[model samples]
Target: MSVLVRRAALTVVAVAATVLVAITPAQAEPEGGTKPLRDALRAASQGYQDARTAIANAKKREGELSEEILASQARVADLSAAVGRLAAAQYRGGSSAQLQALLSSGSPESFLDTAATVRYLSERDGAQVTALKAAQATLARQRKDLDAAILEQENQLKELRKRQDEALKALRSAGGGDPTLGFGDLPANATPAPRNPDGSFPSEGCSVKDPTTSGCLSPRTLHAYNETKKANFDHYVSCYRSAEDGGEHPRGKACDWSSAAKGFGGMAVGAEKDYGNKLAAWYIANADRLGVLYVIWFRQIWMPGTGWRSYFGSGDPSSEHTNHVHLSMR
Candidate 1:
């Protein structure tokens, strides 16, 4: 073989702070506006599309590799059989060499000619054996490529699931409604949880700037953050233009309370963990009354219908939401 097609072995956020994150319903809009959320939703939706494309590509490659593997196996079997036939012929001829030559040869020179033929056959067999070995090597490489492609397909599927999960979550949070149902921000019929007489949270003690637009947070997020402030917890809080906006922060519809002693990458534990648990519970307890979307803290996320569940992501402290409680408004 002039060219041996070689198969290369294919080797394949902490959250801190008093974060009060919110999940916006699909088809609903933040009181602030929809521009930022729309952009975020678009991005999330795009991610899902990309994942699907990647999975498709992976599967296609897997199929091609599988075909190539089959071809390689067939070639190897054929070459082995060819080599076997050559060896068998050589064995049979060598077994009857003298006797067969005497029966067919015209004279002693015929014996010499028969010996030469046998020698030529032996050389051909040796060459066939070499070719057979080469074919086997090629088969081994193709099988390796096939296995790698299979693994790649599996990874792509996993990625597709993750992206789809996140995209669905984002769509629901962005009030895009259910994309599958072609609805936008559908309204809920559930009676809202009550508020204080003054239309404030139960404590009615949190303070917020009046304007709800521009750089100001939406009403619900502001209320949640203010609740933290009103508690006199001596904690630090920020509501707008966070690095991880995804629409809520920059649009001023989200608030993240830094729950960690350190920032961003800090892992919350011990007292920090307790604080996050209590805060998350508080938000869940007040969700309906405050128009809260969702709450994320301590490596977990909780929304209205679903209870607490493990939130998997980049696995960093910030990604885990262990450093803060992120709260957003609808």
Candidate 2:
């Protein structure tokens, strides 16, 4: 072969090799798979840590609340004692010979003294009763609010524990497995059979589709996802739908659910570069049973890559979503 032709052929072959290496699916448990799993594990671990912290905080609050209740009880007791003293004084004054003598003296100064003394005793009794009742009412409200807060904290801890268990299970299952495998060792060239874009599942149900409408998922599918993950599927769907439909997401844009399982768009990175860590966490916990893997927000507007890291805040640039959750499967 001519030198020029040979060089051109070599260059083409090198380029092709690079592309194949880049696009070829990695082995089971490839770094790609492991990365997302690790990220999810980290997030779950963090959640566990947070739950522990919250429990501690709740305990502290309970202690403080108990003290408050005790203090309120003490105040009530004090007020009751004051009322008793006032009652005794009033009773004595009303019947005492000294009071009677003052009233009968007929001197203007003596009569004035008796009237003042009676008024003072009556006012003091009324004031003590009012103060006691007010303290008791205040304590009741504080106790109720504190009790509710404690319940909420307990629920949060329960959810955290559930997620932790799932993460641990995944880690165990994936042990010594290649992290780069897509869809549990499925071939990378295996394109999923096309389905109706309207978001319906196939009869055999190897893959599931999400509705084009914001936040639409079949009740069965939602139940399956929630049951598998032991997480709040409804809340997730609600949040996604709200974000997609609230006028910010352009019409006709739908979230990509399958990408989540396939590790699309460098999704494996958990530390900071991973844009969809929370979404991935949900997917990892639910994907096995749901046949769903990823979710994407479909929109026409361009979102700056700068803000992808904030999972809970206002998405990219728009705030139009007000309802619904997106789902995907592979």
Per-residue lDDT of candidate 2, residues 1-330 (tens digit): 999999999999999877554322221111112345535544554355446546666777778888898999899889878877867775776447546756686789868887787677657667878998899898898799689768968886786767656555544454421222111122122223333333333333212333333344443344444443444222212212332212211211123322223222222223322223344444444433343423222211111111111122133211111111233333
- lDDT, candidate 1, 1-330, per-residue tens: 223322222211112112222221110112122455435444544344445555566677778878887887888888888977866765787647645765687778987788787677668778878988988888788777778867876886677566556645654564433322111122232235445443433422123453322355555556556665555433445565534425456556566655653333366678876666666676666565556655566545554433454443345555456667767555
lDDT of each: 0.55, 0.43
Q: Give residue 108's lDDT in candidate 1 (0 to 100).
A: 86
Q: Estimate the TM-score of every prediction.
A: 0.38, 0.40
185 in model 2: Cα distance from truth in Å? 33
